[model samples]
Target: MNYIASITSQGQLTIPKPIRDKYSLHNRAKAIIKDTGTIIEIRPLPHRDILSLMGILHDNPVVKANRGKPSQQIIDEESAAFEKAITDNVVKEMGLPPRKK
Candidate 1:
């Protein structure tokens, strides 16, 4: 489908909904836009899942050690909930079917 879009004064152009849907570019998806001399190219960046964040906190000794924590259990529970939220968000953003419990 060919679409003619107007660029705003802010130099921003809205990608048509059909194209966004086709490329799974919803929910603030990142993309690479470049002028290839002959043609302009727009490609959606790869989507990362929660598992990819593993070891992200390793460098943060305070958080990694879990030291000076009074309620480790509560922290663990909240972390689990946060992980679930991240997973759910990724699924929703990618327009994938919800995971079964």
Candidate 2:
């Protein structure tokens, strides 16, 4: 289906109700934008929980090398790494000192 939307002066375009409903999109839903030189694509970002991502690294060499370890251990390590990345980014972007743990 082809739909035309006009961008306002503020550079915002409203997603039509029909398109939104078809994609199960709701207010505050996250959308990913991609620019492919020819056209721009917008896609809904699916929500995921930690439980749904468990065991994804089971086949990884590191995980295989360290066999018998619980998946929670890997999850905790990954979570820490993610948190550190966020903290580092905030510190660098805002010129703020690192927080005391």
Candidate 3:
């Protein structure tokens, strides 16, 4: 899954479509790009609590619809999903089976 892409004059690198599709990276998705001494690593940032608050502040329709403090059940479900996503990515990177998203 190696790809070579050119950086634009504006200094923005376009991630390949296959990688974006595989990671479910939508428009304006957040990612962390780190210089890891020997190599560079790019990791997508999952939508978290703070991002949810930001969404609410910006009047995101979905966030606005679910306004107010979340219940324990909802919180638990989101946590579970986030954990599963991380686990799935790790397994995939290790060339394991059963991709779950």
Question: TM-score-based ranking, best first?
Answer: 3, 1, 2
What TM-score does structure 1 among the candidates reach? 0.48
lDDT of 1 by residue, 21-55 (tens): 89899987889899999998889987886677998
lDDT of candidate 1 at residue 5, scale 0 to 100 = 83
Candidate 3 structure, TM-score to reference: 0.49
* lDDT (tens digit, per residue) of candidate 3 on 50-78: 75765345667755655674787568777
Show pairs that collide, candidate 2.
none
Q: lDDT rank, highest first?
A: 1, 2, 3
Which candidate has the top score in lDDT? Answer: 1
- 9-93 per-residue lDDT for model 2 (tens digits): 9998789999899887788677889999999999987756456799899789976865877888888887998999998998989
> How accurate locally, in lDDT, is each candidate?
0.86, 0.85, 0.81
What TM-score does prediction 2 earn? 0.47
Which pairs clash in the backbone of model 3? none
Candidate 1 local Cα displacement, residue 57, angstroms:
9.9
Worst 10 residues of 2 by lDDT: 43-52
RMSD for each model, in Å, please? Answer: 18.0, 15.6, 17.4
